[model samples]
Structures are given as structure tokens and as C-alpha cells.
Target: MTASPPPADDLSPPPSCPDAAAPAPAQALQRLKVAPAEQPLSAAQKKFNRLLARVNSLERQLEQLQQSADALRAPHLQRMDALRQRMAQAQRAMAQLLHARLQRPGLTAAQQRAVRALLRDLVHAVPPSPQPEPEWAALRAAYPRPVPAAPSPEALQQLLDVLSAASGETLELSDLEDAGSPEALIEALAERLHAQDEARRAAAAERRARRKTTARQAEAQAQAQDARSALRGIYRQLASSLHPDREPDPAERERKHALMSQANTAHERGDLLALLRLQLAAEQVDEAAMARLGDARLQSLCLLLQRQVGTLDRELAEAEARLAHELGVQVRAADPRRLLEADLQALQDELQNLAEGMEHDVHALQDDDKALKAWLREQARLAREHERAAREMTGFGFQF
Candidate 1:
């Protein structure tokens, strides 16, 4: 016996061909006399198609929900990410101004320490360092003679090798070989180590990137395979019920031939729902017959339906979660566009406030710097006068 037609729901107009042109209705009915009577669908087949339709409908609904959620989430995610970047920039700029203010000369050690402590507190509260240029410079200047870490064994050995090579006064490989002092040798070794470390890091990152790409490709292939499997199952069911070669009546054969062509096209395109609907249209299954199906077949149909429902449920849940994360709220079935607009407005307001604050802090720091310079100049003038007076008193030979 031929396999039964696949379950149906995805409906589309079958493309027309020359063979699709129908004869007169009277002539077609007469042609049916010589053909075998059309068989009524069994109770099992009808029930299976009905359950399949329900499953397909649920799947379609879930797909639409996911698409809608993604559509709503994409812009909001991009906007939020952009706002985060801008906020970080503003915070970093403010930190730089604070750091620069603390850098002015002539403050007492305690006063300098207090200012630095305040800066640290503020930075710790909302740290944002795009490049850390200002912060690193301040650190370096504060500890110009910071205790140096001892050279590694490899570095020491490399230094020794360099010294041995340079021991022959006439031999010189490069300017680096001429490094005679301990500091010079250490610097050369440090440079070499740094370059090697950078190279290793680059190689490691490249390998990780390759692995990620391979994983993504494998995931895509798996999804494609699953789609093909689903379409194949649906196609098999459709072919069993609608094979034109099985229809002996010329008129019925012509009609089945057209439907079979449509089925083939839908299967090729991986349109499972279309195949299901086509089978339903051909009267391969119906509602009343579904109610009379055997227990075994009904149970099998139930299992397929349950599987479809589970798949759709998982997909829907993932889409909902993604949307909620993007919006920073537990969104349900509400209109997402409106909610995202509200979030966008709040973010814009925050961005504006941060920009104004950054600008004000920058101006204040510049003014403070000018005042600091003036104070230092006045102190210098006072010292010069005191020195002149001391010289004059000494020259006058006044003994007190």
C-alpha cells in the first residue's frame, strides 16, 4: 500500500499549467463513469490531519510572535547600547577633569592626598576609562621611582647572553647588544618579553575567533537539517494521498496532477504548512472522520501534536525573554513599540543631563588651573624678595 499523504495546513494557490485547463463539467462527470469511485478518507487519516492543522497553527503563531518581538527589540537594544557608550564617555571625561585638578603643584602633601582620595571615591563609584591615558600618566608621575619588579629568569639569561656576545669588543650584532649597564640590559629584555607576550595574546585571540565561527556554522547546519527533516515528513504524507498516477479517472487525475505539482513545489520550498493544507483541500481528511479514528492512530497524532506544541512553546519563550531583556522589563503580550519609545525618551533625558554635567566640570577645572598658576607665580615673587633682603642684610654686616 502507498504511504498516506502528509498532514496539511499551509495553503497556497497551485500554479497553473496547460494541463490545468478543465473540460466542461458535464464531460468531466461522464469521464468519472469509467474511473474508480473516489474513496472516502478513513477515520484515522482525518483525525491525524485535524491534529496536524492544530499543531501547524500553533507553530505559525509562535513564529509570528518571535518575529514581532525581534522587530521591536532590535532598535531598542541598539539605542540602549549607544546610550551606554555615551554615558561612559561623559563619566570618563569628568574623571579626567577631577584628576587634572588634583595634579596642580604646591598643594600640601595632606591636601593632595585628600583630593586624590576624593577622586578615587568618585571614580570607584562610576568608573569609565576608555583609554586610561590621564589616569595612567598621573599614576606614573606619582610614583616615578616605583619599586621595579625583579627580572624573570628567562630575561636574566637573555641579558647574560647579550653581555657575552658584547664581551668581544669588536663584535656588535645590533645597538641592543651594546647594552652594558644593568638598567639597559633589563630594558632590552623587558621589550623582548613584552613583544613575545603580545604575539601570544594575538595568536590566542585568533584561535578563539576561529572556534566561535566554526560553532556558529555548525549551529546553522543543524537548523537546516531539522527543517529538511520536517519538510520531508510532510512531503511523504502529501505524496501518499495525492499521487496523480493512482487516480484512474481522467478528470480526477488531472485535478490530482495539479495538486501533486503544487505539493512538490511546497515540499521543495520546505513549506510544511502548505503541504498540509493541500492535503486537506483534496478531501484526504475531514473533521467528522477524525472523531472516529482508532486509539493507536489517535495516540500517535497526539504525540506529534505535543512535540509541535513543545517546540513552539520553547521558541516563544526565548523570544519573549530576549525582548524583555532588551527593554529591561518583564514584558508580556503588550505592545512593545510603545514601551520602547518610553524607554528611549528616558535615556535621551539622561544623556542630555550627563553631557551638561561633563561640560560644566571641564570649565570649572580649567578655571581652577588658571588660579593655581597665578598662586604659584605669586609665591615665586615672594621668595625672590626674601632672598634679596637676606643678601642685603648679610652685606650690611649687622650683628644682632
Candidate 2:
């Protein structure tokens, strides 16, 4: 009997890879292939890919959130989150558009409205620009309770008016809550308002984060400018003094010229660390020439930095010495600056207390051991004396 392979219709579609945005069409049609179906893919595979794109889009949004310093607004966090959910729903709608995967045909109509609502919220959160005077006046007037909130009719109407204010657009409202009904304009408008609120919050957070970043960058740039200005002065002074033109010997002058060139290059390149090394190497340069180039300002800056460095170094050395003495062990210098009083002070204090406790314990143990030794010796002496007395009493055979 010839056994036939089981029909391909019995096989289920393979699980889609999450990372794959587009899978091979050949693999997708295997289940339906039993019927001589010529289509390369089935509806399931398309649906999965659309879902992946939606999720990937959401992740990009989260990444944007992380790169920002300002998070959700306090007054509208919950509202914003709800707005985000709507946006996710909107993304689902987008996936449906790609895959044509909606289970219910009527659901598509409602989903589309929801998508618009989400967009409305996003728009409110991050408007293209500030509102016109009349629009702002309307918005401010509509949300009357000294604050704005959901179900604020004035606010809602005002928002509608703002949207309408754009050239030649008519926005209508129906009073029902069912998004499925095109006639239910109020539900659609309310949904849009919620989305707008979320969008507004997201925009506000983004603006705050942008301001903070700009401020920080500005501060760093200012400090860098100050440092470069100071370093350039030092380099110029050193260069003028060491220039080969001042050298008496031609051979020596050429070497000095090379060093001066290196110094100038180092200064231009903002290589402070290299400049320090060059300063050490420039010891052979003429002393009189070097001194003539010195500036009071440059000297002042150097002295200030040196004084601070010296202070910190001395403090660190004292800390290291104390730590070494307490440990009763040679602790190698782990740092060039040694230990400052502020660095690890809490841990050092705890270590000091622990070391003191250990010493006390050692003294107690020594005292206890000495007392035990003395007691043992006394007991032995008494035992020997008793043995001697008994021997004297029993010595009648050798009586002398």
C-alpha cells in the first residue's frame, strides 16, 4: 500500500518572528496551498507584520521620552496616559489599514474616529505654534473654572472654535457617545479633545527638556571658552620668550625654534595636557627670555590653581597617614593626591572605630590568658607540696 503525505490543509501557519517586519510570502500560504491556491501569502502573516510596525513605532516614542529631562506633566499625567492609549489604538488602526485585518467591518469606522481623536490630542499637546490672539482668547475663556478639565463645555467648545478658526473648515458635533456612528459627532469631538490634551502635555514636557539641555550646553561652552582663553595666554608668553630669534647660537636657536613651534601647535589644538609636558621639556630654554614674557594675570591664575591643588594634596596625605597608622600595616599610596578629609570620610570613621574595638578585644584576650597561666602554675605547686608530705609520712623503711 502506498502511503500518501498528510494533506497540507492540516498544517497550521508557522509562528511569525517578532523581529521580522516582512516575512517571506511563500511560507505564509502553505495552509491554503492544498487547494492549489496561487496566492504567495495569507492574511495572518500580513496582520503580524502590521502589528510589529505599530509596536516599533511605540518604542521610538519611548526612546524620545528617555532622551528628554521633563517627563509627563503633573496636573494632566492621567489624562495624558489615557491620550497615549488612544494613540496606541490609532496605531492599531494604522496596522489594520496595512493588513486589512479588522475582525468586524463596522469596527473600522469607529477605529478611524478614534485615530483622529488621538491626533487631536497630540496636536493640542504640541501645537505647530502659539495660537492667534482670538484663538487664545477663546481657549482661555472656554476653560473657565480658573482651570481646565474634561467635560468643561466651555473649554471643549473653545477648542472646537480654535480648530474651526483655521481657513475654511467646518466642525460639527452629534450628542451621542458611540464612535461607530458618523452622526455621533460629540463622542468624536470629546475623544479628539482628550487626545489634544495628551499631545499638549507631551509638547510641554519636550519644551522643558529642550530648555534644560540648551542651558547646560551653554554653560559648558562658556567654561570651555574661559579655559581656552587662559591657556592661550600662557602659550603665547612661553612662545615669545623661547622664540629662536632671541638665541645667540644658531644651532641652539634651531632647537629652540622646534620647541616653540611644538608649543604653538599644542596651544592651537587646545592640548592643555600636552602643554604641561612641553613646559617640563622647555627647561633648557633661556631663563631671561622666558621671564620677560611672563604676565601678572597668567601668574595669578597659575598661583590660584596651585594653591587649591596644594591644599587638597595636603589634606589627602593626612588622611592616608591616619589610615596607615590605624591599620598597623603599610598601605601603599593608592592615589597621587593621597586622601582628602572629605573623600570616604564616613567609611574611614567606621574603620577607625572597628580598629579600636579590635585592639580592646586583643587586650582583653591577653589578660585572660595571663590569668589562666598563673592559676595553672599555682595548682601545680600545691599538688607537688601534697605529694612531698605523703612521701615523708611513708618513709619509715628509710627512716634517718
**Candidate 2 residue lDDT tens string, 267-337:** 76554433443443443212222222223322332333343345444544564465445433333334322
lDDT of each: 0.57, 0.43
Look at candidate 2 and tell me the lDDT of residue 99: 26
Score every model by TM-score.
0.40, 0.19
**In every candidate, how many clashes are there?**
11, 7
User: Pick by lDDT: which candidate is best?
Assistant: 1
> In model 1, how large is the Cα lDDT of residue 133?
70
Q: Compose the digit string of candidate 1's lDDT tens values, residues 78-155.
A: 766776666656655655665676666756665565455545544554533566677545643553343568777577
Taking every candidate in turn, the Cα RMSD to the unseen true structure, in Å, is 20.4, 42.7
- Candidate 1 stretches greater than 4 Å from native: 1-61, 105-235, 240-275, 281-283, 322-400
The alpha-carbon lDDT assigned to residue 226 of candidate 1 equals 52
